[model samples]
Target: MSGTSEGPTPAADLNRAVITHSDLDAPPCAEPLPYRSVFAAAPLAMAVVDPEGLVVSANATFGALLGTPAEKLAGSVAADLMELTSDARSWHSYREVLGGRQARLRCTRRLKHPEGHSVWAQVTVVPLPGEGRGVLLSVSDITTRRELQARLRHLQMHDPVTRLPNRTLFFERLTAALDAESYERGGTGRIGLCYLGLDGFKAVNDTHGHRIGDRLLTAVADRLTRCADEAGYARANTPLVARLGGDEFALLVEHSTGTEQLADLAESVLTALQGPFDLSGRRLSVSASIGVVERHAAGTTPTALMQAADTTLYWAKADGKSRWTLFDPERNAHRITRQALASTLRPAIERDEFTLEYQPLVGMADGTLSGVEALVRWNHPQFGTLTPNRFIGLAEEDGSIVQLGRWVLRTACRQARRWQLDHPDEPPIFVSVNVAVRQVWDSDLVTDVAESLADTGLAPHLLQLELTESAVMGSAGRPLQALQALSDMGVRIAIDDFGTGYSNLAYLSRLPVNVLKLDGSFVRGFQYEERDADRPSPADEVIVEAMIQLAHRLGLTVTAECVETSAQASRLRGIGCDTGQGWLYSRPVPPDRISELLGSPGVRTDVAGTP
Candidate 1:
């Protein structure tokens, strides 16, 4: 060893190095006295290494551990014998101990025995006590402890029935693959997953026994493993298949090329499972729905990836199961927005985040604005103004439609009363509010209506209630009685989206309905003109004319919805449609704009609109 100009000989330098690291001021012996006979008979595997790393001496136990005679073990490299040279960090520490700089070095190593068996050994090194400049090395056999730990880990990380990696290990591998340095060793920087569930697996358990289900799961796992093995036979890294409890399984692909690779894997799995599985004397058939997601691993978390996979799996089931579905961010975004809106809907009403917009319903015969349909708009703070189509169904599904309907009724009535007061002479154009079936079933709709009329001082005749044609049919219990009671109060009851529902006019005539809003499908046919303007599209005209005549006989006035063109308005008016409501008049406009429209003569005839 070379020394600096400020230092003495290398021997003196090593002595100082050894002394500096010692807890007590222990001094190094000038020279090795000699080998002791006791060392050869020691029970532990031990050896002596000189500063240069050559084995100066070895006990019989150490020689036996390496399958060599004690005499021949001398002069061999101690690091090579102990297999410490394989790890750069451990080898460096060993050299430091031999140089009298480090106090001790300890690490575990797997070493091959002379019998061709490998065993885990914990190696420890320290400066020789009375031997000059050399270090003492000892190796302890920890193979039993290591094997126990491995067995415990296997039990913890694998599923018992399928003998495959469980959810815990699946997530562990997923998190590792999503790590920034996952592919630093060099490969494509993408991760993929094929999350699948057995279609109608519950039915299998219900029809059969759980033992059969477990055996079936085991069979599925074996097939999945074979698929994965076949897919990876030519590649260095193979995809990992895991059973995530129940019948759900996941195949994680590390360093995936792209979605194409995942798609291939998912398709192969689907095809492989197409064959039937035989357990004991029973042969059973099963299918899987797979959700495949593959993307650059950068900036992705385990939770995010799993969520995307879960959502895609749902799409597969929705798209008629036993197939694979790839993730579409656009569709996912729409669903996310819908969920956000649903969560905020109930609170939005309390937050005053709702506003009313009115679309004028003009009398087709005279072009007079007979009424305005009050449509509710959600002026969400985050998503901006959203129409009924975006959140109405969600609200209905979650039972929030009751509260929302009440708000719309009161707000529309109040605004209608204000318009009447603003221009007292103008025949108060009635404000029609749409009602959902859930509102009638879930709430005291009659009391809500009466309260709104009383609170707003709006006349019952001036406020019309609209229910879908489907909702109004088969009206017997509360819904039918509610309609009857509302009609008795002079509040006109109209069946909305007519001509698309049951179309049972007899059953409808039995109810107290006063109006029928023909569905837009019936009016859309008249939007384009036929070669002979004298004969409108008869397919549509015949349907509309017959419906209008039947409705007239039932004494129910008709309103044409989605009336977009002047030709459409004229044709509907010619068919005796009592009123027409659509873009032809105006899209739903703000309350102030509706008031402005009322001051004019009428829409469609007086106003040329293209919305």
Candidate 2:
């Protein structure tokens, strides 16, 4: 055998050796190496089998691979040694290779070893060129390599700490489900997701160490996994539970029945998390808010679905944590609209897309228009003219209210100054601007007001700032001082939407407030047809009367809001309400329309009862 070849011989050489039976069976000699020596000493695990599939001879490497001695491996049935041969297809392949129907066969299979553990190997069988029709079999153990590859893949797909599927795998599975043929065919293939956020999870890391937090997260992952398994057993498809980064987990249901099913899953998750967690000899409790989104799998992208889920999750958090919220398309559309508005706000201010609308505040006693509230409107190209109700709160949330509010103050002051010049003969009508709480605390509101008055040349007395009752009630320290400075500068301060908030009447007398704008709820009570003498006034009449008396006693003028009927006006006047602001005077109109109202002689004559 020439001192044994470096590796296994080629297939052709093996076939030639088998054909020359005399040389293969010859005993080894010192003169030269024999074929049997090379075959026995080959590096690869190899064997020679007869046409009956019996192992006639096997190399030492083959015996080692099978956990048996070389001599004992002979005469054993080769098919019985390999566990994969139990499959019908593998048996057919073995028969075909031996019967010469196939020249060569190669397959990867799990082979049983005498030591009890299974070995993964690549098995190749090639026909020999002998009359007996023998075959050469080769086995290569690939268990270690396969395990390494599997470990790398597992690391790629799962979170290291919790050992759960990560966001990458979750998204991949979600995309596959959405792209399934059943979904394309519009069958009953609906998908659902429960996007959950652990409430107050950051506090755990803050109070305890991060190690404890990590252990708590592992426990959460385990609970979520069990819940997913339980849910899967009850349904046709298995649920995928994944950790979407810190403190967030998601459950993917591929074949969701309906919204009810998703809701039930969310409830189960919440209930599971209700129990306290035990970590490092300490007990900790945490709750979760889940956003459930269920819809037809077709015509939806992963991005859109996740966005909807995120929005719904915020809704769950907002409505109070530890609860589940179902996705609402209409509500989502509204929120998207608001977000679009918020995104456009800063740019709109730069582009001067905002314009002012003024509503007349009529004196109830003389039916004379006393002032106008400077209401802001957005001339949105896509949404048309939008009221402040649509975007003011959004601006406040994003901290852009300060800039937007400043713009409004300057613009309204300039417009009011123009009106003062245009209607010199009319009584000075103050322009009341709505001030957000953020504007008061986060901005130099007094400076902004002073600058607006100086730049627009409008008198400070003619500029009234209206703060919500809640904003005023919560004002203290810097905010209260800001209000006081603005008031001392002769800028009138009015509490808008009165009676709807804390109504801290005890603190009311100390504030620099000059006016109280009664909420619409109190005014809506009297918005009806004139009652007969026998009929009594509505119940709100007493409330409005008492509020008006209280305001007068506090030296604050009373303004009744939402007075849309003649009876409402009459009652407000009877209760000595100083001013009435509502559609009864006029819906908020353009600055030009306010000029028209100021110029019109019938402005006072067209009272609610003038008809």
Candidate 3:
């Protein structure tokens, strides 16, 4: 080695020619411009080892990596100076570089310095353009670089909180496997996915804040990871757990043994998650619902597989959480239809496809119109005009009930104002609107009602809100506060569908409620009789009498709902029911029809008839 120094040798003096074996075999026609300058000036830590594994020359960085002087590096034997530990089998692997048979030999091994400090290096041996006498070696102290790359890979592919592969990496692996299956010589290929949701996760998040919720999720991930590790497959194919988001997670299983195997894995996951999470001072219980979708003989597309998993997961939730459900094409079709409907609802409202009809509430005493309950109808383009009974329950579940409820409030308020203006002296019959639980929670009910009243100039007293007893009873915290605020503004509050809820009469007086609309179930009992006459059935008279007395005691008015016949009306009137609304009076009619009935007392009296 010429000019053995501390810093890298000047590049101008270094060899720049790419040596070819054919040229090396031809001659040494020029002065021996030894490749020593090229080795010393190289950016990578480069060296040349003779057949005896002695270092002939080393780059500046190579000497620095080994903490040895570049001059001293030449005489040292490579194997003697370095400590090597690796899984790669043979030292002869490096000879390929010398004979120009192989391009490189890369291995991870520890390098021992003269000062006794150990360093990790990624050692690469490449054939120098020389005779089979010496080989070129490059050492990269990749400890920091490799560790950094490992950390970066972890951050990119795994969820920070759960340490599970995220959707991105999972999908990438799935797509790769799917591609491999496409070209494989095997007769057919299949992939399975298990979509999972944590049951009662929201309740836990609600009871305990997000911190504990995260801990619980971490615990769940750990359990799933353990299961994945225990699975016996070349790539550890139990399931690739991924947190899609929130309480939802998914798993990808390849070369699945069929539906039975997938189901067994799902069962294992559920069993693993069945235990309680001891999160920082909080013991929270959680279970998982799994939706399994196995590839059919016709094969599965990635989108279809994921969608089937999603649909099946919903089935698991619907079938009552903490269980597994297999994907069925027919069931998914129904779910897709419902999802389509839900997505279209808001746009329908925007397109002026919704309308309200008025159902008359008749005063039981005089047989006259006391008020009209505004019922919503959706004139859906695809499904035709749908009644509240068709979609109200679904709307409430999807949280679209809030927007729908607002529409109903505004429309009913506007109609009541019009009715008051048209009739001027008919004592201003109040218009009632049903409030769903979702509406109560999602909207500032007080502001909505107050604003509706102001916008339509409808009297607060003439605008009654009918909340189902369950809706009212389940309300607490902000919901109860909103209802109380509405009551303070002079709006009447009525509990609709009363008897079906828990009979907590204690809530009646305390909840600012003014009326209770007996549920139609109890009212139907007045006329229907059970098979065994000896055994008393749920009697309407007994329930009505008790309710009426209870209402009086609580200073609330009682209304019997679904009163259809003269006999039921008579029974209700005799029992002191203040108001009644049912099909007998008239079904829900358009605004014009309501006006027609209000204008003609003959029609009202004749409609009341024998009742």
Reference-based TM-score of each model:
0.88, 0.75, 0.57
- Give candidate 1's total backbone clashes: 0
Global CA lDDT of candidate 3, please?
A: 0.76
> Residue 119 of model 1: what lDDT?
78
Best by TM-score: 1
Q: What is the lDDT of residue 257 in candidate 1?
A: 87
Error of 3 at 571 (Å): 4.9
- TM-score of model 1 relative to the true fold? 0.88
lDDT tens digits by residue: candidate 1, 56-156: 77888888778889889889988888877787788777777787776777788888887999878878777765535587787778899999999999999
Computed on alpha carbons, the lDDT of every model, listed in order, comes to: 0.85, 0.84, 0.76
Q: What is the C-alpha RMSD of each candidate to the true structure, in Å?
A: 5.9, 7.1, 10.5
Candidate 3 is scored at a TM of 0.57
Instruction: Specify the highest-lDDT model's number.
Output: 1
Model 3, range 81-124, lDDT digits (tens) per residue? 54432233435555444455655566677666668866778676
Alpha-carbon runs more than 4 Å astray in model 1 = 1-42, 50-56, 96-103, 128-134, 527-533, 605-611
